[model samples]
Structures are given as structure tokens and as C-alpha cells.
Target: MDPFKQMGDWKKNMDQFFGDNFWDEFEGIIKPNIPQINLYQTEHELFCVLNIPGLHDLEKIDIYADMATLELRGVIDLEFGGGQVIKEEILQGAFERQISLPFPVRSDKITATYRNGLVYIRLHRLISETSNKRRVNVRLLEDE
Candidate 1:
């Protein structure tokens, strides 16, 4: 006699036949979490190149490093007004990516330079050996 009651009854039957956990597991896989990263390691140091364009200010970039981990945070603006976006593929928003370093580096000595569209960062490897006291005898001057 009631339209609302009929729809509710149909939903219950459909869910029971399909199993109650159907939608539960379906939603989890449908929308999943993904981490963004691109990293490589060489014998000397580890290199990480992140694709960041339209970042104007140097203060926008934040880089921090510890003994093993390095953190990078920045924002990529997607504000291009007055034009309709027909197709959008690139990510544009606040992004924070953390990468693990292959070897430890001095945080104070780390240098970063941005050019073109990529951010280049150089991390110096920690020095294990330094010049110490070692005396070598040299022969007196001989004129030829």
C-alpha cells in the first residue's frame, strides 16, 4: 500500500542476496590511498626528483633531513582562472613527500637549487676520514 515500504523491502532483499559485506569491501578498494614518490640511490648519495611546476617562491619549499629520513613539503597551485579546464591530469595542491636517504648527510651542508621545472638537491655524504698528522720527509733542494 506504501511506495516507501516497498523500496525499503527491495533494498533489504538485494543486500541479503549479495551479502552484507559486499558494499563494505567494495568501497575500500574503490577508493584507496596512494603515496607519491620518485627516488634513486647511487654509491655516493641518494637522488630524489619531484615533479613540481608553478611553484614561485623559495619559502614555499620546506626540506628537512635526519639521519635516515628526508621530508619535503610544498604546494602546487592549480589556480588558472578565466579558462575552463577541459581536461586535467596533473596534481595541483599541497603535497608532502618523505623519502629515505641511503646514507647520512650533514643537514647544514645540504644545498638545493631550482631550475627549469625540477628541484635539484645535493646532499653531501658524511665525512668519515679527515687529514691528520702524517709526516713525510722531503729531500733538500737540488738544482738541475
Candidate 2:
């Protein structure tokens, strides 16, 4: 029996069983449902854009910002109006997740805005390490 031929047959069988969307299904299982976000950094601030459609009642959303972390707690609900769900793709229900910022920010100076079904959060940088630089003098010890 040829080992290469057996391996080829096994590969064909596995491909047929998993089909095209196998990887997509696997990714969904691993990550579950979480709101997608886009983060951008600039010299003065860090911006985060969160995709949250069909989410009514802005008051239900809670966002907490810190120098190193950003916390979000929110609920998303969509009305289908008395019908069995044949297919549902959007994430719905309550979600609580903390996002870590790449650079330290001034929590007190952070600002946020909501427009066109998107939440934009701006975290002002807190003396980013790139800007605040100081040189220390090195002292040599005398030999005994």
C-alpha cells in the first residue's frame, strides 16, 4: 500500500465533509458573537469606532475609559415582530467587554460621539512616550 495515496484519499474525504464554509463556522464557534470595532491612533489621540446597528436606547449603553483600558457594556435588540427566525446573523443581547488601548490616554479628556448607527470614542493621549523623552546622566563608580 502506498502511503502517499492513502494520505491523498484522506485529504479528499475531509475536504468534502467540511465544505466551503467550514472555516467560517469554526471562527464563529471560537469567537462567538462580539461587536466589531476599528481602532486608530494618532499623535494626539486614539480613536475607536464600534459597529452597533439596530441598537436602540442609547442610555442602555455604558462606556468607561481609563488611561490603559476602555470598558463597554451594552445591549442590542432588534424587533422581528412575531415570526420564527429562519436566519439570524446580527449579534443581539447584552455584551460586556474591555478593550485595551495601545497608548496611555487621559481618561478625563476623552470624548465620544454617536452618529449614523456608529459610536466613535476619542481618547486623548496622555504624554505619549514618544513625546516625553529625557536623558539621564550616567555616573562612573570609583575603583576601590
Q: Which candidate is the best by lDDT?
A: 2
- What TM-score does candidate 1 reach? 0.58
Residue 140 lDDT in model 2? 100
Give the Å shift of residue 58 in candidate 2: 1.6
Candidate 1 residue spans exceeding 4 A from truth? 1-37, 128-144
Report the Cα lDDT for residue 81, model 2: 71
Give the TM-score of each candidate.
0.58, 0.65
- Give the per-residue lDDT of model 2 (tens digit) for 1-144: 866567657756876998756655555464464667899998888889988777667887888987789899988777667877545567677778788888778877977778877899988878744755678899999999
Per-residue lDDT for 131 in model 2?
57
* Tens digit of per-residue lDDT, candidate 1, span 40-104: 76676766666777778879888888876888888877468777755545657676666778788
lDDT, each prediction: 0.69, 0.78
**Model 2 RMSD in angstroms:** 9.7
Report RMSD (Å) for each prediction in the order shown. 14.5, 9.7
lDDT for model 2 comes to: 0.78
